[model samples]
Target: MLTKTVHSSTDAYTNFTRKEWASLAYQASVSLTDEERTQLQGINETVSPDEVEEIYVPLTELLYMHTKHSVNLHNDQNRFFHRETKKVPFVIGIAGSVSVGKSTTARLIQALISRWPNHPKVDLVTTDGFLYPNHVLEERGLMKRKGFPESYDIRKLIRFLSDIKSGRKSTEAPMYSHLTYDVLKERTQHVEEPDVVIVEGINVLQVNKKDRRISPVFVSDFFDFSIYVDAEEENIIKWYVDRFKVLQNTAFQDPNSFFHRYRHLSKSEAEDVALSIWKTINGVNLEKNIRPTRHRADLILTKGEGHRVEQVEVKKS
Candidate 1:
């Protein structure tokens, strides 16, 4: 159980250490096997089964509680308004720096939430697909600032979220190919009446000032819940470089991969390239755009060394 020592004095949030948070895991209804847990981890991510049990289990239980209440509220409101009750998917947004393990967190939550008998259908989508196509980015001279807030098609992303929230069937999102470093025009992720949708990306919680006057709708406006993963910049850089080295030997080796030209480089050279990219591109975006939006998330997961979640902060109700 969380103690007074773990709680922050601030009115905005209640903070808890890992052990304090884990004590709530007993409330989690489902468990995962080693294989299932392994499958949820991202490349070079250091999450373990024990970590999943201690961290994500209780988190999913909380999401379930929120979803149940949302459904009940929707039903009561519909009856009061004399309108037909409709199923609206509970949308969860996960945001963070490029290598901060947001994807792993989203996947783990989706897996755990889907295992429940009531909400058997859960879908996960990455906002990489919402990014402008490579040619468009090149034309707009945004290729260098690829992951920044201006690089996304905010209007399209909002429309997609709008359709999902309205319970529209067969809504589709563009598919991005990391190997090709581009969007596949012919491929799309078709989402159909899911019980829950988990949207993961660095831009999910970003607020585009450019769109505020024109649209008045931010990307996170449709989110029922939001999570921000946090880690020190140095640690994230190390993880990014490590993942780059692994990709150099694996994905970069594929001739069709956008980064295939770098596959022949020595490990040191690969690490240098990764470091340069992080410092100039990803790190700049994280500092300027992503990290600033961390305060907007409903929950923040702070990671320490070895990509372990050391603490959690939940918005105080």
Candidate 2:
């Protein structure tokens, strides 16, 4: 059972149990077919129809409210300055540790938001594409730190966001392939004036020392809203290992997969490899880079066993 907490006026955030949060869907409800729900779920992640109706439906409503108000404010400012009314995408940043189901949450939110009559064109972009190509990481001796802040082309990411926020007609982002474990140099995701843009990544909320000094803007600067997915470290490790094992049996079997060699390993051997990789890489990155930024998010979704969103924390305005 989950314990409910009451928020004090002085508290930085208002906390809500899953039941309490689900009630916020009072306005309008959207249902997803099993096929749509399945398409949004990540590997080793299961998102039930109930979860979609109870959690994400309300979330979509809240985002729609913000998006509507933001447009109003933008129009007000444009009228004040006697400028033409232009539409800018409401950018939402989602950050969390690897294997914590942030990708699924992002995709779910994107799907729901798009269904709203107000915002039909919702674009989902993952920051995996912003990561330095495998060859670049190899040259920099940062292959092991691939998801760390330094491994991304921060400037390029900033410029991409800048373009979207500036209301550019069309912009392109590099594409990354999990099968090849590298950026596909030949391909790109073309985003054309989307109503809402969801930028999902493990390092979306990171603010490194150099970024504070050398860079004039941070990635979060472009966000109108942001979310961080939270779960126990042990749970995340278990999920990571479980996902790795599933990949070993499936995607790793493909000869073209970067991890194709992993398919030949025995089950126990694969588990050991996953554990070693987690402890040395993903775990370290989470502790040092990702988890620290949780407090910075406008909303935090805390998950319990089985990837259930047990609690939510909304920052007080």
Q: How close is candidate 2 to the true structure, as a TM-score?
A: 0.94
Query: Each prediction's TM-score against the native?
Result: 0.94, 0.94
- Estimate candidate 2's RMSD in Å: 3.4
- What are the per-residue Cα lDDT tens digits for candidate 1 across 1-317? 21221213246888989999999876554677877877878898766876887899888888888998998999999999999967699999999999999888998998888887685689999999989999999999999999998889888899999999999977999999999999999999999989899999999998787555447788899999999999878788889999999999999999999999999999889999998898899988988899888889899998888889999889987
What are the per-model C-alpha RMSD values against the true structure? 4.3, 3.4
Query: Across residues 1-317, which tens digit of lDDT does each residue of candidate 2 receive?
Result: 22332322227888888999998996545778889888879888889977887788887788888888998999999999999877788999999999999989999998888788764798999999999999999999999998999899998999999999999989999999999999999999999979889999998898756555447688999999999999888888889999999999999999999999899898899999999999899989988899888888988888888898888888988
Candidate 2 pairs with clashing backbones = none
* Candidate 2, residue 299: how far the Cα is off, in Å: 0.4
Model 1 regions more than 4 Å off? 1-10, 211-214
